[model samples]
Target: MTDLHKHDRVNPLRLPVVAVQGLWLRSTLRLASAPGGGTSGTAPGPTGPPLRLAVLGDSTAAGCGVTGDDEAFAAGFAQEVATRTRRPVDWQVVGQFGATARRVRFRLVPRLDDDLDTVVLLAGANDVLAGRGPSLWREDLTGILADLSHITHQVVVAGIPPFGLFPSIPATLGRYLGERADALNAVSREVCGRNPRTTTFIGSPAGTPPAGFFSTDRFHPSAQGYRFWANDVAARLLPAQPDA
Candidate 1:
């Protein structure tokens, strides 16, 4: 069978194992606390008005798994941008713990500020876990990008995390979820390619992640992982500096 077919196929025997693991994870893993402020905050930079940034979508966007908002993905990314551009960043996070792309499109998208310099989207993992197919994933993501592109000049869509590498998941389930994530990412690339204002940020580090990359749950990123992710994204978003 083709690769697509292979991804679509599910072994009936694995259902029980998948169910047990899912239940265990749900019972054991608790979402990290959201940052102290309401969903918005400012990361100080050298000078000038803050660059407006919005991080929207699922748990990662909400900064789950990190100790606090300061150590989360959005804040870390904002800080990186501010330091590199020598300008303060006004960052906001609009996200839910288990949001899928469709949920973000309908729910979180409406919450975004009217004036934004950049919008970063972190979604699709829940959709993969939900067993949604690529077509649905593509449709939802397209609408999200369309809406965000209308609001901001730049919309950065984060690629799906490497589920196969997640420490908490079993090998069988991880492989399956990984394949699904890959499929969704392919759709993301295609959707972003069509929009001039949109770009897919596939900034995962090369090779295996080092120790402390994941939090206690081994699903969401830890502080160190957020730093790595933020640096990679900031590098791509910022323009190159001139030689001294």
Candidate 2:
């Protein structure tokens, strides 16, 4: 059996725990209000046409855990790029809560503006939660990269967050899901490697996040969490400049 299948095979003893955690997660989601209003904005920079950037994926892409889009990953990354590159960034977010890689490919990718300078894709967590195997994750991710290739040469794909460390998840269930996420990220790295213009933004090294890293629900990143996450991703996404 493949490694993915091995990971997919959960201990029957843990099934009840997994089910309970799933229910708790659902309840938390129900209580959280989806962030509303415009999903597009600009980060000011030096004179010139702004750099067009589109952030597409699931709830994290939608900035659900934060009170405002400005505090989300997209905006933070945009500002970082603008500050570093000295170019105005026109950022747009095309995302939905609970979206999987396949969902983003079909439903969100088409919504991206054709003129974008870069497309940042943040997905795959839902695929893990949905119990999708690596083969399917690869197919969906491959399709996403293929589609985005037609739109822009620069596509930044963020690696799946570490599920094992989520404070809200029970240890056993979290470990199971975290392994699945790692498997998906391996597939992601492979897929992005094949695409010359694609770069996988693997966030900070795995460790237990500090208090407040997660929002109240404890499932998604809080604003402070996003800032650190964004900084890491932005550093990777932007090209290195020579020292003066």
Candidate 3:
């Protein structure tokens, strides 16, 4: 769902601040050739543990056009994480339609606790649709990521897929949305590059346009679209080591 965020600065919906722990954990399953003592430095790493993850964004994160809450992007991502890691995962959801990064900082940032392991950003589309400039969006994003420092074990930004091709929207407007997506994604990528722990943006399936993956409104993603989203994430996470 491409939800919209109000431009009001005076008051926005405030998220409840909850103290959380053990966020964004990576669980890997591997066969041990030999067991080592727990007291030794050579001890094998623990295989399974729950990772605390937070999903924050706009309408797509909110479950719009979805049949139920479970069908949303956040829910599907959680399920996928559990399956791949074989670890219990606790996910916090804070998504509002049409939210810009500014709204997220004001409405959601203050409510976050230090234990959050991962912060998944699915924003920018609405900002574009709302006709906000790229600089404004980038500045807001930088602020959001800055404030989230130390709170996130890993920072991940999802690239805005091409919204211009949606069948339901006006062609010119859709293209504008698509261009904004690409531009914002570039900013997100640059932000991630500056931080070692951050995960670069992963966009949708190759050549798949918004129209083909979205709902009838040509905004939200179809089930098949979510499938592609999950696959891209898994590709990034599946590697046991990145710096290695």
Candidate 4:
């Protein structure tokens, strides 16, 4: 059968599967409760000039699955930065759940202050789900970076996590979404490469995430997962510094 015919023939069967997965996700989320809101703080370190860092993006950047801001990636990364520099880290999060790059550009970007030393952006999952093409993603993401560049000396754009590995999503849909994420990541990398002030951060490797990496909802990262992700980003952002 032609690929088009095959796709049409199999779609009816896939629709029910997709619906079941969607229902399961909704029920699980209701029971798990939403993660606490964004976190901000100054990490402990030897008294010195502090590194002011601002984190921006979607739910992941907001620390969705964690119980509090301390357990979120923003705080975790701040801790890592403090340890490495032996200097205090002043961190703030301006992340919103379910926000696309466009939303972040128009709504969140304006809230950023002018004294930030660095900015970390972890986004693109929502854009993938929203069916935004690579070109559009590149445009929105580059715009966000351009705006951020004016506020901070350094900007780190993180690669989207491997959502296809999420336990809750159906295999077929996960595969499709994975491809979309890959496209966006490529754009992210290119955008970062072209900008001297911006850098790229790669998250966990592809394939299934280890047990306990995700929260009960099987989507957002758990506390442990955020810690792990923060460490990875820290390594790239401060490669010269030793672990603390």
Candidate 5:
């Protein structure tokens, strides 16, 4: 059959399959558009040539507290990557605000591209915030990381940041959250240690957290928070690019 077909109002692949780089991934498909024209599909396009980044995590990565889509970690991260690499960047945000590692393994992990160069993972806080045991949270994060190893050779495990100090939650609960964050970060660091392509970074509140970084909710990081995350992520990314 013809991979190339006229995608009109009736058939959207009307957009020609322009060959980019060595791979022929459908531009329209990448652009989140259907083969048929005159419609909105999830057709995402490449920034420069063909690069894929996957950012998966909880509310922070999903930009729940952030005012606009640009404020989201995924969007901000992509923008930072574009600036750093001086090329257009396309990253697919595959995270639910309260997602756990188990959910990512079964749901988000399956949707990733086989040739993904980098996979940034975040979780654990939600697991603990939900009152789940830290041991189970460790297993979930490790299992998900192991699963990602099959597809992405490079994985960046951002240790769960410290949020307990924030004024948003109760002091008692904040203490509990802080302790769990430490525990889960330990687990994540261990997992990263064992992987050849993995690296871990400690993201705690004590660092240079930008003013207004926290969203209005005072719970999640604001646009500034994501901007900081992007810079931090880029630092980790620089080292991995040579190996990737």
Candidate 6:
């Protein structure tokens, strides 16, 4: 982390700007939460050996703003992989709203087992929201990845999205938060890149999100948005398939 005085001196308007942003965020955005945790399901498809997959992280991993567990990122990704490979997919989600990297590492990882073939981690947004520094973010994420490696050789870590691109947040605040998110993502990529045996960074789609991609709350992704996320992850995992 950079020197605090340096950052403060550089961005003199940051405090007031952040204050305005906080007020705007509180007033405009809906308080959305991820629904139905410890979620599990099977994706129906042609007969074949089943692939056990697990998704763990924060709200996005929990499928907040989506109606059912089937519509969540984990389920959507599992279903697509199952359909494409003509294999049965047994998938589960263990996630919660407002979960940070440290929280997920300490709270959720212990509950998982080593039976999973793959694990997808969707996190860091909450860390950015809480103003966590890049170093702390890297430490917690590294620990999480290490714990996950014991359970599965394959782990996909989703890069943090552009928080400033969300429509609900004020532009100034969005820019500030976006910079922080970018810093966190850089840490994630560096950590994953160094651990080829266990971790791979699958980035979120870049650029400003299109209209209707966000849910009614304008914070979490809509179902259509989740589909896009699932598709991206599925594509990465598909290359590992025997058929590919």
Q: TM-scores of the models, in the given order?
A: 0.86, 0.88, 0.72, 0.85, 0.71, 0.89
lDDT of 2 by residue, 9-55 (tens): 65667766777777766555432338532399999987678899998
Q: Give the alpha-carbon lDDT of every model.
A: 0.79, 0.78, 0.60, 0.76, 0.59, 0.80
Candidate of highest lDDT: 6
Give per-residue CA lDDT, model 5, range 138-193, as digits (tens).
67777887788787767777777775556465444344456656777777777677
> Compared with the true structure, what per-residue lDDT tens digits does model 6 show for residues 202-233?
77786666667888888888888888878877
What ranking emerges by TM-score with the best candidate at the front?
Answer: 6, 2, 1, 4, 3, 5
lDDT of 6 at 46: 81
Itemize residue pairs with steric clashes in candidate 2: none
Q: In model 6, how large is the Cα lDDT of residue 49?
A: 88
Best-to-worst lDDT order: 6, 1, 2, 4, 3, 5
The residue ranges of model 1 lying beyond 4 angstroms of the native Cα positions read 1-7, 10-38, 239-244
Backbone clashes in model 4, listed as residue pairs: none
Once model 1 is optimally superposed onto the true structure by TM-score, how far is the C-alpha of residue 216 displaced, in angstroms?
A: 1.3
The residue-level lDDT of candidate 4 at 153 comes to 85
What 10-residue stretch in candidate 5 is worst by lDDT? Answer: 32-41
Scored against the true structure, residue 52 in model 6 reaches a CA lDDT of 88
Q: After superposition, how far is residue 57 of candidate 5 from its true place, in Å?
A: 1.7
Pick the winner on TM-score between candidates 5 and 6: 6
Model 3 backbone overlap count: 8
Please give the clash total of every predicted structure, in order: 0, 0, 8, 0, 19, 0
Q: Please provide, for model 1 over 1-244, each residue's C-alpha lDDT reduced to its tens digit, 9 standing for 90 to 100.
A: 0122233555667656656666666676565545322377888977788899999989888877866658888888888888888889999999898888989999999999987889999888888888787999989988887788778878888888887788887776677777778888888888788755456555355678778988876888888888888888788777755543
